[model samples]
Target: MADSTSQPPRKLAPPRFIPPALSETAYPALKTGSGFVSRNVTVRAWGGDEKLSDTQRVQASGLAGCISGTTGGLMRGPRNILPGAFVFTLGGILGQLGLNKYLRHQAQQPAPGPQEPLTERILSSKWSPFSRLSDEKYIEIMEEKILRAEADIALIDDRISDLRLKIQERDQRASTDINK
Candidate 1:
């Protein structure tokens, strides 16, 4: 019997936001504008590449976003400036959300191990419709699969035998009762 003290397997939590990789880029225009502003305005404003911190980056991005958004809005219509301010704010929030989700995903991912030369060679093989495994490795994989199939067949046979035994016992009892 299983131990009563053993805990149930813990389930992983559903992610709070969709992973950045799966989702569409949130506000492409904002991103392009922010980048342009960062490259032009922020660089000039802050005296160019002093190795900014994360806070600084966000601040610069916000400033750049505001400048670009305001300019775009102003160019579109004089009346749009007020609405553009609100949109700029919303865009900043959404950009932050996207960045945060991306960072979390990066943090959660396991660091990949260095690839073995043989494995790398096999993966890089140019041969179409054919595996690049060595003859021994191919044989080993097939043997492993055959062993697994044999084990599954053994378990199924055992179940069938058990069921047949139960049926025979039931039949014998019924026959005996009828005779009696």
Candidate 2:
């Protein structure tokens, strides 16, 4: 009998539609002329090289429609609502533009290769705004600042005590002159 374990496992067929999560590859073979039309038809039609599945395209279309409808509704309101409407429309447009830019940037980034430890990834990521100083270094910096502040407070207290002493001496001299 043939040994099943000795034979290499067969490869599975590629899915008809690549999942949206997996479509962020360097080169994706997208469907060229899918007749499916929707609100985001313009964007989808022009995205010749980006592989977007039918569901994703539809979702994008729905989102675009919602934004357009909300903006249009706001624009048609009374004069009192004009300012609010303008702000709403402007914010919506800016948000959509920002989202597009972010998506494009993310797509351009290379996919993760071998898995690294979570701590290592977080420490190395450029997105973090915090300094990556060692614990000891951070403690030393804080201690130096605290010591400097304490010294300044001590100097101020000493100056205040000297002023109080001078005021007392002046009062005693005035009293002696008045008694004389």
Candidate 3:
């Protein structure tokens, strides 16, 4: 007894391939295959069957900083888009607190590690960032940044006052409608 059975071909899903990392091997300097041509070549191209360049390694290292985000075929490097990347975050914060603008820029580009606390960065002598300024001129610029900061704070306060007025009007309208 022969049991006739036929299974239709299963629709094959399209393949999605992720590129594997390149191999790691150092290509040493070796003489070319030309029997006695007295020529010294100190450099050679590093493509195909050779090692990756230092730049490629550095870029790969930067990507490792964001490994958790690369699962499901997505690529979002951590350093590329940090959490608090708002350009003027420090400015807005100091403005809210009525701080000086000189302090804001100074705080932003502090002298220490590229991203360190303001006080620490300023005090680290080894990371001094004074090259961009002259002592006499720096004093004058500081005054200007502080004055601008004060003006910005005043403007924000005025805006807040106007918002308060609008809120009061909306409240009054709601009260009148409830009474009716």
Candidate 4:
């Protein structure tokens, strides 16, 4: 007979990511001309830099759009059409562009030419920026970036929750507004 107290161990695979909630007060802030675009860019850029596949990146982008639209739909004009899906698409595009910029920056670095100093010579230097930080520094910097991204993601979730509450409050007020 199988042991009643001991259960089969669950498998642990890749990490599951949950995005942050949108805030209600943020709706006006998000809907502002450049504010919305900047928010989308920030979210999508973080997604691109992380381990997410292209499909997942696309999904993140879409969610960003939906968050904006749904949060404001109640008070927005009929022509104030903000779509979650469309905004997500745009966000993804912007992320790709940012990624391309990084790639191009790397490619532009010159290869070791004959005129360049040899490894030993460069090592002997006392004032080189390259020598100041070792490979460990790069890893540390990367870790800091991941932490910031995680915080931003958490913010997104909080915003989303706030947005929901705002929607409910708005709904409650709508009847009075119409009657007035």
- Candidate lDDT scores, in order, read 0.69, 0.58, 0.44, 0.62
**How many residue-pair clashes does candidate 3 contain?**
0
Model 2 earns a TM-score of: 0.34
Q: Write the per-residue lDDT of candidate 3 for residues 12-45, one digit (tens) a residue.
A: 8444233333211211111111101111111122
Look at candidate 3 and tell me the lDDT of residue 145. 99
* lDDT of the structure predicted as candidate 4: 0.62
Clashes of each: 0, 0, 0, 14
Model 2 misplacement above 4 A = 1-111, 114-129
- Provide the lowest-lDDT 10-residue window in model 2: 26-35
Please give the TM-score that candidate 3 achieves against the real structure. Answer: 0.28
Superposed Cα deviation of residue 89, candidate 1 (Å): 3.6
Candidate 1 total steric clashes: 0
Clashes of 4: 14
Model 1, CA-based lDDT? 0.69
Q: Per-residue lDDT tens digits of candidate 2, residues 1-115? A: 8887797778985442345465555112221111123334755564732676444544454444444544334333444244543454455455656666777798899997899
lDDT of 1 by residue, 60-124 (tens): 66666676666555544567666775677567646855786788799799988886798566667
What TM-score, computed on C-alpha atoms, does each candidate reach?
0.40, 0.34, 0.28, 0.27
